[model samples]
Target: MEMLTLECPYCGVQADETELHAGGEAHLTRFGPGSSDADFEAYLFMRENPKGVHFERWRHVNGCGKWFHAARCTMTLEVFGTYPAQTAEPPKKIRDAITAKRPGWTWRELS
Candidate 1:
């Protein structure tokens, strides 16, 4: 397995994989109480495991102890950028970086 060195979007510190924790996929809708069983199941288990570009949640445990989203390539382990966790979508800069590297990539209808 390869290691990833990502920059903490909050603290601006570059940390290796050992200093951070992987929090699975980012930008997922949460299903709380009163939601259907299927919706809750999907929320708990369903996730995108693509072979190429991917976005994921990462916590800067050793640095600022804050969570952020990272855009990277699953196949090549190339990190495009990292952004604040609170962002609703990937920022324009990150998207542009992915575009420059990927050419024709799209995630959940955002191209």
Candidate 2:
């Protein structure tokens, strides 16, 4: 039997890939007509290419279908914490949880 461990980016649970789902990139906010080329570049390409801690958007496509932000370290492929997406501000628990699990990881709330 073959299995891969996956983290649920919404509920902060670690389970087999069978129990979780993969969603694409996070923090994709659209720009207005007056935006500059640099702004477009920043939006399209110059975003975080982090090696260690990174914030990504994912969905529990199999479980709840809710979007979430995953605090992950790409170098180690470790998911320290996950929180609900579309949050106006990261809840204290989410911030604390990420800090406790992966220090120096920043979680930005996306609208």
Candidate 3:
């Protein structure tokens, strides 16, 4: 495993992996009290572990102390870009970067 570095979207600081905490996959649908047990279980545990491009949540624990989203490649560990956590989807710039590196790549039908 190589050392991972990510830029904090809020603070614009390039931070090493030690300064950040991974928060698992991003853009998950939350299932609450009224939801079925299976839905809740899937919400909590199920995740897409793709071999290629992946979107993930990361917290800049030692920088801005804020969460952000990162589009990266699982196989090569190449980060496409990072964006604010509040965004509902990957920004066009990030998506373009990924597509430039990997043509025909799609993220949950957002290709």
- Tens-digit lDDT track of model 2 for 1-111: 545455664555665656655554565666657899878776677566667666666666667667676666677776656667866445677567667866666534421
Q: Model 3 over residues 21-85: C-alpha lDDT tens digits?
A: 99999989899999999999999998888899999999999888999999999988899999999
Tell me the whole-model lDDT of each prediction, alpha carbons only.
0.91, 0.63, 0.92
Worst 10 residues of 1 by lDDT: 102-111
> Tens digits of per-residue lDDT for model 1 on 1-111?
788899998988989999999999888989989999999999999888889889999999888899999999998999999999988789999999999999999776667
Off by over 4 Å in 3: none
TM-score of each: 0.91, 0.62, 0.90
Worst 10 residues of 2 by lDDT: 102-111
What ordering of candidates by lDDT runs from best to worst? 3, 1, 2
Query: At residue 92, what lDDT does model 3 achieve?
Result: 91
Candidate 2: which stretches are off by over 4 Å?
1-25, 88-111
